[model samples]
Structures are given as C-alpha cells and as structure tokens.
Target: MAIRLDFQTEKKQGSLLITEESESNKTDVIRGFFSLFGFEKEPMQTTVYSPEIVVHSQGKAEEIQKQVSEAINQRLQQLESRPSKDEVEIKKPELINSKRTLNPTIGEMIGGAPQQEAPPEEPEWYQTGIKNKEGVPHYKLRYWCKNPQCRDRSNDYIKEDQKTVKCRKCGQKLLVRQAADEHMKRDEWGNFFIADKLAP
Candidate 1:
C-alpha cells in the first residue's frame, strides 16, 4: 500500500510550528522544533507518524501533502481547543417508604412476641388442707398417702392428729381428718343424708 504524507503545525507563541512530518527527510526539522516546544508537555503525544508518500510519475510532493494536511490540521485544532468537563447532575436519592403507625393494637404490638398461658387453678373438690398441731407453720395434705388423697372412701387421717380414731372391724387406729369441699354426704341403707360440714 502507498503511504500518505501529512504535516501538522501548532499555533503557539504567535507563530505556527511544525509538529508532524509525513516526509522522511523532515525528521530533523520536527525533532528540533519539538525539543524547543517541550514535546513532553505538549498535547501532541503521537510517536508514530504517517510516512511521506511519493507518487510514481507526476505531481510535486508539496502538492501531494495538501490532501493529508487537512487531517493533521484538524487534529491540532481539536487538541488546542479548550476541552471542558461535561457536568452530569446526579439524581438526588429518594427516601424509601417504610410502614409507620401512630397507635397500634395489642395484636400489632405483640405480633412477633411469644405467647404464654396462665397456670391452671386447683379444683375446690380435689384440694384438701391439713394443719400441723405441733405449731409448724406450713400446711400440707392430710390423707395424701392413701390411694384416694381425700378422706371420702378410705381412712380419715390428718398429719398432726392428736388421738387415733379406732376402726370398728379391723381395729386399725387411724387419724381423723376433715373432708375436702366440706359438703359431706353420707349413705345409710339406700338413704342419702347431707352433713353440715359445708356450713360457713
């Protein structure tokens, strides 16, 4: 392929200076001028330049340079022109919409909290209390050792019974204890009778 030749002249210090050369014979001219211009500080940084091309049979090299000279001059205009930074305005960040409330219900306040059930109450008929006669402070169940903790069927024995109540058949001396619930009922020959232990 044939090489295209071009020349770049920078407009600085009121006069135009050659910064590029497409002709091989013009190296010394470009280097000396570039050395004075401080090539390191200049905006022109291209090390590789377009080679000066020679046409076969007709036309001068100076005339050949005209076509490519426009391209080099255009590049110099671009570098010399004041390059300004483009201002890109960033969109302000928006606050996310979170759920907030003024007054919340009990369900909302404890929505994620663990639930606890109340302890069960002891039944009146199933609970019986026997006191200590020896001046002990704490009260405990009297006939709790028997199969039926209450004195309804088996022996009536409080923990601190002073005297033993004798059994008629077995002669087993037993302790006398109070009935639970206090509404005691006795049965005699198919007849039912209510005892007054429940009276206030």
Candidate 2:
C-alpha cells in the first residue's frame, strides 16, 4: 500500500521551518489538525504524495520518510533566505525649491546688489492775482519743475488745459496753490493764511 504525508510550515526569527507533519493512508488529511493541537500553523508549504513509494515492507517506509523530509527542508530554506514585506524599508524622495540656489556665481553676486533711488523733491506753487471782465476777483495757479538735474528747472511757466498738471520737460507732478482773496498772504512753503490787520 502507499501513503501520503502533508506538512505545514511557519516563520520564526525571519526563517521558515516545518514544525508539523502528518500522514494519511489514502485520503487527504484536513489541515484542522493544528487547530486541535491548540495553535494555528502557517499555510501548507509542501505535500508528498508520490505513487512510486510503496510500503510493502518497513524499510521502504523509512526510505520514503527520509526522502520527503529532505525535499520539504530544502524548499523551506529557499523561502527563508528571501526578504519579507516587513523587513524592507521604503525610502521617500526629498522635496526642494526650484528657484533657490545653494551657491552664487561671480556674475550673480555682482548683479544681485540692490540699487538705491534718489529721494523725491518737494513741489513749489506760484500764484498770480487777477480779475475777471465782470470785476469778480480770481487767481491763476502756476508751477514749474525745480529739480536741479532737470532742464525744466529754469522754465518760468507751463501752460496746460487740464486740471491735473505735470512738468513737460521732466514729467514730475506739480502742486497748485489757490488764494481765498488777494489779501491772503503766502508763507515760504506756498501755504496761504490770513495775516493780522495793521494800523494805518
């Protein structure tokens, strides 16, 4: 007669080992044997069910057992040497800013220095008193560029039809001063204020 033997293996200390094996005379043995023994084993690894191995004598059974054991042990050793999912370490890629530079070249260092701009000049307004044809009092506001570096610094008058005015030569914005009356006196800063009345 012939016999079949089924075995299950387990992993321990990062290695696979056959901890349990059972024999069946003719039929397949259910893997529930390990559960009855109070613990569950790993999945079934190797099964030895060769029809050539006959048990006519006890010596033949011993030989069959030796051959099956060697086959199962060799397969287990192969599985053990391989790395498991938990044993592998997954490395993530590092992030970096595209515009940032670690080192500056000679050309970049020379051009990178920030240039300072010249401070703006204060505006000056010139007012001229005049009267309308109906004798209703009015005044004309005038201004010109005073920037020493501009060609328009000596330009006495700039005529414009629009209310908002800028220097024609230098393009700098000009301020305007309006007097409430001809008697309104102007300070050095172009601001108008009523002066105290003087005795005749």
Candidate 3:
C-alpha cells in the first residue's frame, strides 16, 4: 500500500539530514518512522524534532523510496567511519586515590572496593538530671532527632527521684530540675539546656 518514513530528519540550511541512512532497521527504522507520521511517538531528542516536523511531509515523499534507499545506505555507512567492534576506545582510569568511592552497579558480582566511611563520631553527652539552682547538678534537654546532618546523642539522665523527665535519646520530655546550678547546652533539638551562667 506504499507507506512512508523509515528514518528522517532534514534541515539542510541548518544541518540535520538523516533521511533513511541504511540503518538496516534502526529498530524497524524507528517503528517505520513513527508509523509514517501519525507520530507513534517513541524516539526522542534532536531537540524533539519540530521545526515544522523537519519541514513538512503529511505523506507521499515518494512513499519513502524504500526508506530513502535504506537511509542513504545508512548515511554512507556512517560516513565511512568504520571502526566498531563496539568501537573499542574505553579508558576511565584516573582516580589518584583521594578516597575514590561510588559503588553502584549491582549486577555481575564485582563488589568489594568501598568500605572506608568510618570517621564521624564525637557527640555523646549524657547527663539529664536537670537541677540548676545552686545545688551543683544540671542538664535539662529533650528530643532532637530531627537529624540536622546527624551524630548527636544527649539521651541524658537523672530522674532518680524527681518523677518525670524523659529523653534518653529522643523520648522528648525533659527538665526535672531547672533553677540553674549551671552547665549543659546542646540545644537545637539534641535537647539538654542548663547554662545557669555556667555555675560551678
């Protein structure tokens, strides 16, 4: 029934002419060039091909002269660049050891070269008894697991007989003593706040 399109893209004065380059079958010439223009829409990018769909052709451009002679013999066999064995030119080896990481391709089982991330641990201030008024024992903070870049743990303690003051690492309600015997400030959520002027 003489259809059309097998490979196309022509902008002559601006440079994008591919008209059927013998792609042998660039996947059924990109599914018969989008089913000969009803635009089955699959291929993408030459900036999404639209300067009037590469200069008009609602059909009958000699019904794709055999997909334009197999896309002009596949663009003269890709302009005679002839080198492919999958064009052997691979070379990605320049990491000088500054801690080269990125371990992602989970397939052919080639793991084991990225186990060096253990250097960020300095925040464990425990002491939530909360007693701030010139008696010598303070630390009133509670609940700060919001995770601002992690690594803080004031889970605090000291409820021996004050009755209700939790936050042993995010339980939230703390402040069993606050007259300010003074000394404990981890704020911004990690909780623990008794700076009675840094009392003694």
Rank the candidate models, highest lDDT first: 2, 3, 1
lDDT by residue (102-199, candidate 2, tens digit) is 78857668897466788766433333433243554433334545555663632222222323345567666555433244534444544332112121
Model 3 lDDT tens row, 43-67: 3322213222222234333333344
Tell me the TM-score of model 1.
0.18
Give lDDT tens digits, candidate 1, residues 1-200.
12232333464422223444446544444444445555522344322233332223223333333434555566667756855555545587756745565766577687845568788887442344333356652223222122133333332323333334433334434444433434232223211121222111
- Could you tell me every candidate's TM-score relative to the true structure? 0.18, 0.21, 0.18
C-alpha RMSD by candidate, in order:
20.5, 17.2, 20.2
Over 4 Å off in model 3, which ranges?
1-67, 74-76, 79-82, 97-200
Model 2, C-alpha of 148: deviation from truth (Å): 50
Which window of 10 residues has the lowest lDDT sum in candidate 1? Answer: 190-199
Candidate with maximal TM-score = 2
Q: Which has the higher lDDT value, candidate number 2 or candidate number 3? A: 2
